[model samples]
Target: MGRVEPSLFSSTSDPGIDQANRPDPRAFWVVTFAFVLTVTSFGKYEISRLTPLFFYPVTIGTLYGVSARALLRKAFFALPFVLLVGLFNPLLDRQVLLEIGGYSLSGGWVSFFSITMRSMLAVTSAILLAMTTPFDRLCLGLEKMRVPRVLVTQLQFLHRYMFLLRGEALRMVRAHDLRAQGNKPRIALSTAGSMIGLLLLRALDRATRVHRAMLVRGFDGEVRVLHPLRFSWSRDGGFALGWILYFVLVRLVNLPEWLFGWVVGR
Candidate 1:
């Protein structure tokens, strides 16, 4: 079988290095879920309060050696949808909520900013999870958590063969280019349609052959892992508990405000 191409959703290319340091996938998922839930619990206009929640992703990504640039790049794709979600807030909410040196801050803008920040944080956490956790491992973790087998299998196959489909499409494009004699840089509408249909046919054929091969190899619907996942209570449990407590604390206390008050009070 061809190696799975490295992508944002796959773990680091070196399995040995990651396997030792990586937290249990199930624990990581729980921590991520808790963090996201805590983030959304903040009020709609409490943008400043959400500042402390940013530390989780930053710290985790740093420890995992996942660069901030890559995380931000992946998170950038979700910003457009985030913007659309809050696009009408500024217009609908014109009430002045605060003032700074003769300038009034409108409630709409505050809410809009809050929405944007919360969304970016949540999206970054999810992307970070995908970056650190291998897709197969993630599916396995979910299966262990009692997720439906069919759903997990579908996710597994989708992540597994997406690159193969892309490769096939690339080959078709290359063949088209070779026959075009370098005359057409862009494919015509009709040619593009034909290519799409042909790709679909090829993908179907490939799936059939793969299924037969799997059957010959004693294929079963269960996800089989080389090493069974062992969740260490002292390590993985501590990891999850520590993060969950931090999330709760950050949610309950506005650390930025408290720090600022202490500084000024001194």
Candidate 2:
């Protein structure tokens, strides 16, 4: 069976809104705050306390229409890298640190737990940001935040052509499927070579056509984006205040320990 396409919801039906609306600065700040919080949370060696931090981004992403399954899948992809790093924590430090339920665990185990939790938070926060923000807007936001012009231009170009390349690949796959008559041929060395050659030729032709089109439209090196980003005082202020309060409450106060301990103890 073919893979089911996800049901995507947008805030507006207008094409302009769907394709190129300016992202709210408030949302951007909130996402940024979550990212900073996630990173700071990892610097500590406490696993139990870090559990509460997950709820921030989880709630934000869920409310913002980011696919939870997609986020989890991305998180899982990064899991092996995280686990590999955590694995060394157990091997390098072998001191008994804690005892629970008649079993004594090493300090390495505690360190490993903290490392894993940190990795999860980092990965999840990144995935959440990517899911909520469109690529072009993200680049634009970075540019607004004073990133180098060269880097921003490079990112925009890369993102634009990556989509083009993926579309080309999809077309090639569909053409191959049509020609194969329901037989899925394993890509051997010879077939792979021929496919690569064909794809390169097609890509070159497409690039030529795109260049011609650009020339026809008065081609310039600089890409002009019409929708300029504007900062709203109220939105930005409210967003900043909310995150500041959250950070103070979560990190500065011992609320997690007090709340969780009371509930568990009760």
- Tens digits of per-residue lDDT, candidate 1, 1-266, equal 11222534332243534565789989989999998999999999998889999899989988887788877877899999999999999999999999999999899999999999999999999888887877767777898898899999888777656655776798999888988855777788999999999998887788778778888888887656686778999989999999999998898888999999999999
Cα-based lDDT at residue 55, candidate 1: 92
lDDT of 2 by residue, 63-174 (tens): 6655677668768989999889888777888888888998988888898888888778877776665555555556666777777878877776665555556567778777
Instruction: Compute the lDDT for candidate 1.
Output: 0.83
Q: What's the lDDT for all of these models? A: 0.83, 0.65
